[model samples]
Target chain A: MISTFIRHELKAFWRSKNTGKSIAVRIVMIFLILYLFGCILLAGIGMDKILEIAFPNDDLVKSFCGIVLIYFLFDLFMRLQLQELPTLRVQPYLHLPIKRNTLVGYLAITAVFSMFNLWPFLLFLPFIFKIIAPDSGIIVALAFVVAIIGISVFNNYLALYLKRKSNLNGWIFLITAAVLILIVIADFWWHFYSLHNISYAFFGRLLTMPILAIIPALLGIVMYYFNFLYLKQNLYLETLTARKVKIYKSNTDIPFLSRFGTIGDLAANEIKLVFRNKRSRSSLIIGLFFMFYGLIFYTNKSLGQGWYLFAGMYMTGAFVVNYGQFMFGWQASHFDGILVSKINFSDFVKAKYLLFTTVSAISFVLTIPYVYFGWHVLLVHFVMCVWNIGVTTTIVLFFANRNFKRIDLSKSGTMNWEGVGASQLLLTLPLILTPYIIYTPFAVFKHPDIGLALLAVTGFIAILTRNYWIKQLEADYYSKRYRIAEGFRNK
Target chain B: MIEIKNLKKIYGNVTVVDIPHLSIAKGESVGLVGNNGAGKTTLFRMILDLILPESGEITSNGEIVAGHEHWKAYTASYLDEGFLIEYLTPEEYLYFIGGLHQQSRAQVDETLTALGDFFNGEILNRGKYIRDLSKGNQCKVGVASCLLQNPQLLMLDEPFANIDPSTQFRLKNMLKDANKSKGVTTIVSSHDLNHITDVCDRILLMEKGVIIKDIATSSSTLSELEDYFGVGQTVGATPVVKIDEEENH
Candidate 1:
């Protein structure tokens, strides 16, 4: 009966339009990741021919397996955040002859088969086959993959159940904070000790005999049962109701630019929309954290150089485009009224660009602390801020004008293809390459500053041409208002 | 005056609304009535240019709805609390809309005074975000926000839905004053025919994406609406009784 419920969910997924889209997206992601991994593996093999690290062969393999498992854990955590489970569907199933345990059990089982489970294997299998096949230990790779996938399944279900439980108890953020702390601790230990190679160490132990793979595999099975128990106990409406109320309350408290008068009011409203709305808020938070990502590459003597400026700008600006690219469509749910209101569509677009610029400015200011060690770093931050405000904001707003799907902020980041479309991709192409493709030639030749100047100028022009962009946004809003509204009305 | 001519809307090969022509004179209190999917909301949205009709045009005071030209100076709509920025407290939302129309904060306060009872005692002072309010309270805030603007044209979709009985009666009076006293052209959509019959100068009965009946409320007998909704006459038959059954504990 449990299997039947699982099959029923599978059937429903197969029938859903969104599920079809999800599957297509998953398949594409799988192939893309696999192709990328294949290329990387080939590169690694080529690199191995040129240079080999002195670490033992088994150590490398175990390291490879450990990396695969770590990626799976991160992927599972992200999947939980991005694709909040459709617990609403359970409402109907509850009334059916189906027992709750059967439904939940099936859900957990189905979770194991998610694409998050597939990609790690794609990356791991090729590396194992390339390196370990000669050792006659291919089964270690296969068994490790299975165990990692099982643990990932366990993690996904546990995270979802915990989220559901938190939703009921208004402790979602608290639970998430706890989980994040644990993951951070794990990451800290892993990074400090270079323990990514631990799996290779374990696999080396297992290589002599295939039966040793059973150890981790059996542990994975135990964790899966624990997940099953958690889901079974908390599968009720009462818990979910608690979560809903808490979510509703938190939504009200999200900070915004409330002090700026009417424009401030508007900005505050946009801030609330970005924060209170589940999907957009996650992107915002991700963007906020991503501000520090530039520091990863720009450090010490390498900092303040042309490459650092461009790379830092590109990295940070990528976030501006990433989070701001969806802009108005994030409000597609009520975009009709917003479109028709006395507010100018240009002002609306301007407001978004302004907000993105504001965030970029804040990010640039934050980077100033990093700049103190090298005052020249401020030059990079200055140029990047201009590029982000000028080029990135315009590009983001341009595609944002074209985006029609009303993304459910709560459900965003969970599913693979939640808010993606052709325009969004096309928007990204220019954003990624423009800094390099257009400016690199100048920089590579005699004048690096000229390239930087060009970036700033282009971005400046984009920013200065606010009226033109506004007109364009208004036209787009008029043309697509109904389509946008219809998209939002879907769910 | 507002004019809608040959308005048609299609969703995935299915036409949801196709109206040949419709017009409401200045100061006309028009009530839109329809079944659940009967294109009433769609029509109101069209008038506000919230949704564009595939083929046809809507004009208000001689300006097309597509551009901001006419709508710039005159038009206000509250289809739902979605139009209300949910994070705002009721006071903030009211002031925000008031500020949009250049209403002084004092005027905003004075206007809320007229509709004060709609919110129970000091609901605005409750410090609860409008989003955190119960459905009934949310609707009251929305209604108050829309009315606060005092624009020439007002569009409210199911304004009275979720509003308590006392508040509903007060909103009706407010609508009546906005029309009769201020000469505001008001188009309101509701499933409750009697409430509309009591206030609207013109009543349109919509069925399945078409206006089956467009009768002046002053000309048509109350029995006509009763018959249309498939209900027998009472002293102003309450269509909301069905809604009340669900709203009441």
Candidate 2:
């Protein structure tokens, strides 16, 4: 029965339009990663004779393993992040002859075969095989893959069980933050202080001796069973019940925004949409985490103080362009009524642009302490603000047309990979590259300030061209409304 | 007023709805009755302009239904929970929908004033999100939202399906009051024959994507209506109504 259920589930998954595309993307990504890692491994092995460059030692391998562990945890958590099964649609099956345990077990096991699990092992197997074996290379590589896959599966089930046991927002946030902090600290300790070196050396000795390879494989089995137990214990549907959803008071009472006339109401709605929708709200929080990435790049660099400003601007300004691109389309599922309503699409775009500006401005304000490194940081922040609002907004609006996937707002706060398509990939290239593209000519001419000025000008144009772009959007919307409607229904 | 001409909706090769020249007058209380897959909901969606018909045009108030700004101002619907933003607490959604219709918070409060008995006040002051509410309570919130908007054209598909008996009674009366007193045009589609029989001024009997019987409530007896439904005929002095079974066009 369990096997049959699993077969049925896999068949359903394979038949799904979104799932099939996602699987194809994952396969391509794995191939690319394996190719890149293969180059690194070959370089390590071949360089021994050419340059006598010391091969990465057990310490580096152990460091790599620790970082990989952190990556695996994030991946696993992401897979089970929201842990919302498409159970409602399958509710009728509950009354069928199929047992609950069989259905639940199938789901728990299928969770192990996630896109996150396969790529890491595929990427790392060749490198580990090079380090460990020559004659029995396949066996050693198999052992490493088994162990990592087991660890990832364990984390996957553990995250799912946690989500099943408690759907409390505050608790989930606290636990995720705690896990992230611990992983970061452990990674730093292992890398700089060499805490894991001796342990890996011992493991390496055992591996050469042929006994430790057996141990990892055995440990992998144990972790797998441990995760299986966790899932089995928490499979009850009622266990996943969340606390009542909370309604927040509208913040339209704020001055300035309230005084901005009709634009104010649209701005307030945009903020409410972000707050009221789980997916948008989650991105906002994740954006906050990304803002600190600049701190690491800037503080650790001995490069001139000017570089700090640039790095900081890039980090903080990243969120606006990245997330703001989805804009009005995120509300596309039920957007027909909104479109037909008295509200203007121009106002919708303006409100979104304003929201991006507000968020980026807030991020800039928070980065002032980091500017203690130099006042050039403020210049970077100013430039980033302009680039995000002006240049990034135009690009985002252009690409927003390509993204038609209707995100399920209910499941958005968790690690949902829904609505990601080839279009999103196309959207990312220009977002990441356009600033450099626009700034390069000025850089080549040895007038870096001119590049910044151009970025500012581009942003200013986007802000001013709001209606022009909205008109273009209006024309595009009429033409593609049927297709967009089709995409939403298919998902 | 809404007009649907040659409205055909096909899911792949299956034609779910294939109506020709159906016009609903303003301020008319109409009930749509059909079995599952009878295309009642599909026709309602076309009139509401939620889904476009493949080979038809729909117009509301002399304007193309597709382009009318504030079409939603005159039209409010709750076919299912899809129209409700589940993440919001009932109060928030209620207020939000009300604001969309340019209604004040006080107006919404006045509209919801009678819901205290129906909901036991748990929905409003209880700090609970609408998604967390029970199925019955959620339906109540859906009904309350539509009522708060006070739209001219109200489309409800199976509103009583998940609602409690008490709320159902309140809804029946409220709908009747809206039609009679406020002149609000309502189009209610339900599988429950009694709901349409008891409330609608004009009940439309739909079968296989076409209206088979368009009988005024006052002109038909309950048994004759049942016979028209093809359940069975009854022997009585009640007049028999003609049901057009061959309107292929």
Candidate 3:
């Protein structure tokens, strides 16, 4: 039965509509995994030498034992971010004669095959064989290997359980994150307790008493049973596969947006789209993270002044570049309704412009405190903000028409390349280089202020002539609406 | 009033919708009945200007729908789940559609009150987004939003397929009211012969991308459609006993 299930999964992957894209993504992921495992292999082989250099006073084996807990803790955090839940199409088999335990067991067992489970071995096996074998003979080394396997299994199941619980009730994720953060602060800053001592207290004994390793193996079995029982009880379609109704307070309206009438309504609907969907919300969060781009360039004085423009452009325009790259694709789900509704194409284009302008303006405001780096940084951000609103916004919207791939907004944005196309890759080049094209000539002749003025003035001009750009975009959209709608409907 | 002129949509050599000339007059309630792949949806899409026709064009009130936006002001359609903004709650989606037509919140609330019977208390004020709603409830939300527009021309494709029997009865009354009193031109495609015959004044029977029959609805319309679909033969024919006997053995 398990073999049959695996064959079905393989066929599903190969027969899926986006198999080519998924294969490309898999190839890239294989290379990345190879690189990461190679680094871990090297680290494991030289663990003794590295630990000896770092801690000259302590014994190398003891130091390695102390950091095992730390490594697993960090591993848990990474797994929470990166590990995907193993999902099978259990709906088709639910009414069959097969028992429910078999399906749940299949899911739980296949989940253990994740890279998170393997990384522990690549990081610990060589060290275990080289250091523990000669010191305590073969039995203790084998015990250490068993302990590593037990701990890896425990962490793997624990992460999957937490992730599933968090999907049903999101507060689990928040509470877990808060607890992890508190732990880090307590250990690193407050000196409340030492994870190192606790780790060694357990693992240090395993050096002499090989039988002590059975504790983690037992704990791993307990965690596995916990997962199995949880899955067995919640195996119904409603609890397992169906999206639960989120109990959100019904307050999506923006009172101020009502004043703009139809255009405002369109923009307000888009704002709701961003906040209410997983993919768009994560992209917004990522854009907010890029506001810290100036910190890297400004603190490093060796990088020179030219890099500041690039940083400022990215800082203020990240949301525009990130969100606007898939402008129409975001609305692809409802493009049919949008086309047949009372919305004008020009107003549709303007609503997008309105959204980009508002977000870019807010981003610029957030970066104002960076002026402490020097007034020049603020000047650069201001010019870039203008350029982003006037020029970058239009460029992003123009490329949006070329992106025909539909994006499923319910999916997570991290590592999801659903709507990515060649246009997205090419979009950044013009967004970064357009201002440079106008400014480089003046800066080359030792008149940097003239370059800044030119960029700002060009942006101001574009802002003044936005209606012309709107007309151009409307024409472009009319010519491509059929193809765009056709692509969206295929999904 | 909608007119199709030599409209043709082909997918890889299989013509999905091919019409030489067809026109729906103002204030006409038309029913389109076809099996799957008979081009009912493809025709509706072309009329909405979502799909471009290969040979000709669709005109709404003398304006070519392909490049014109005028028809959208009075035309409201709900073809499938794609027409719905699934993230929004039912109330939010209705209000958003209302706001598009410049309907005030109070006016929209009034309309919602009028639709209370059709909604059957399952749609409005539900805390769930449309995506989380069951397919039947989603159908109610889609149809109710279309009615909220008070449109001069309304189009719905397979609206009866996923709704409850009670709501289907209520929907038939609503369609009658829209056509009889308000004179709203409605185009609905359905697989339910009884419901389509009850709701529409004119029925167009299509097969393999061509309309095989167009007739005014009357007493014999239901049986005629049943005969065309071969469902009427089962009424007079002898029951097949071999399968039941074999199963018993």
Candidate 4:
């Protein structure tokens, strides 16, 4: 049954749309994994020597043991953000004469194939072979390997269970991320206590009493059972249907945008889409998070001024690049109605322009506190704000007409690449590189002010003729309406 | 109300919608009947300008449907769930549609009140997004929203496909009343022969993207279609092809 399920999964993946692109991405990902493995292998082989040189007074094993907790914590954080739920068509099996336990076991076992389970062994196995084997003999080294595998498995199931729980209630996800952030801040910034001491207390003793390695292995078993029971209880199709939260019907419109007539109503719909859907709503949250991006480069007095230029552009145009790249994709779900509705193409384009500019303007204002970095930073941000409103907005919308993939708005937003196409990838080139092309030559010649002025002038001219750009976009969209509608209806 | 000239939509090698010329006049109650893959949807999509034809044109109200804004004013269509914005509640969705046609909130509320029986008290004020509604309720919402605009040219792909029998009867009566009172140029497609014949003044029978029969509705019209479909007769393709050839004259 498991083999048949796996075969079905392979068939579904191969027959999916854009199968060629998915295969290409997989090949690239394979090379990346191998490269990371090489780095970890080298790090493990040379850890004993490096530890002695860096900490001459401390024991090498103690020093190594101190960082294991930190490594797993970071691993857990990355898994929370990057790991995808292993998808199995559990629906068909639910009706057949199959035990629920077998299905849940298949899901849990397939999840172990993830890279998170391999990372620890890649980094630690060589160390145990070269150092622990000779120093404490092979049995203790073997015990440590067993413990490492056990803890790695523990983190895998635990992360999967937490993520599954979080999907049911978003607040659980938010609180988990917050708690993780607080731990990092407390350990690194406040220095109120030390995770190193706690880690060493448990691991350093393993060298003396290798029999104690059984604890981590036992913990991994407990975690697997926990995940199994949780999943078995919640895997019903009915439980997955509706959000458990009670909803209040509040039929309201954006009071300010409603004044623009139909255009306002269109923009209002777009606004509600951005706030209501998971994929779009996160784009807004992430854009706001990046408003603090300047703090990274600005506070580093040793970094080059070029870094600030990059930061300034990103902070001001975060909303534009994040939300604008998806363009008409937000409406791909109901594009048929959009095509048939009594709406003018020009008004539709204008409403998009209004949405982009409004978000950019709000982001720009939120980023103003970064002026404490320098007046120079403020000028760069202000210039990019204009550039975003003018050139970036036009470019984003132009490429938007070319994006035809439909996005499922109900899915989780973290790593789902639904509506992405070649256009979104190519769009980043001009969005980031165009400013550098114009700015680099002037800065190289030591006339940096001229570069800023030229960029601002170009943006100012583009903003001045927003209507002309809107008309051009309207014409482009008119020709692609049928194709876009057809693409969205592919399901 | 709608015109098609040499319209053709080909998928790879299949001519999905190959109509030489078809015209729907104002205030005509036209019903399109066909089995699946008979190009009913493709033709409706072309008329709505949601799908472009490779070799012809659809002109709604004398304006080219491809790149113009004039035709949408008098025409409103609901082909499938694609016509709905599922994130909003039914009431909110209705209000949004009404606002597009420049209908005020009070006017929309009045319309919803009139269709309360059609809704059967499960739609409005239910605090449910259209996505969460049952399939039949979603259909009711889709059809009712189209009515909110009172468009002269209204189209629904299958209004009675999943609806209950009683609601289907109410909808048939409501559509007949709408056509008589407002002179709405309504076009609907359905597989249900009894309801379509009861509601439509004329029926167009399609087979393999071709209109094989065009007949004015009469007491015998339903039985003829049933025979062509081989529903209550000896099942074979012979009688259907004979009727097609006989109707060509």
Candidate 4 residue B203 C-alpha distance from true site, Å: 0.8
Tens-digit lDDT string for candidate 4 (A324-419) = 887777788788887778777888888888887888888788888887877788888888888888888898889888988787787656745566
Best by lDDT: 3
Question: In candidate 2 chain B, what residue range of length 10 has the lowest lDDT sum?
Answer: B228-237
- The model with the greatest DockQ is 3
Candidate 3 at B164: error in angstroms? Answer: 0.9
For candidate 4 chain B, which ten residues in a row score worst on lDDT?
B235-244
Q: Candidates sorted by lDDT, descending order?
A: 3, 4, 1, 2
RMSD of each: 6.7, 7.1, 2.6, 5.6
Question: After best superposition, candidate 4 residue B49: deviation in angstroms?
Answer: 0.9
True contacts kept of each: 0.32, 0.14, 0.74, 0.68
Candidate 1 per-residue lDDT, tens place, A1-491, comes to: 76565677779767653542544555765687688767755654543332245334534544554555456556656665554554665666777787777777676676566555555555555555677665565676566555555555556666666666656665675777677657657657656443355544565566666677677667667767886786678677765332364432322322455444456556666776776666676776766666666566565455435567655675456557767766666775556656556666555666676677777887777677766546656776787788888777776776775766556554545343556655665777777677776577887787877887787787788778867877876776667666777666665
Docking class for candidate 1: acceptable
Model 2 Cα RMSD, Å? 7.1
lDDT of 3 by residue, A400-480 (tens): 888787889887786676777667768889988898898888888889788998899989999999999999988898899
Off by over 4 Å in 3: A17-57, A125-142, A167-171, A242-245, B231-240, B243-249
In candidate 3, how many Å is residue A245 off?
Answer: 6.0
Candidates' DockQ values?
0.29, 0.24, 0.75, 0.56
Instruction: Provide the lDDT at B151 for model 2.
Output: 79
Judge the docking of candidate 2 as incorrect, acceptable, medium or high: acceptable
lDDT string for model 1 (B156-237, tens) is 8998887877877888998998999999999998877668888898988887788888888864546787776774545455
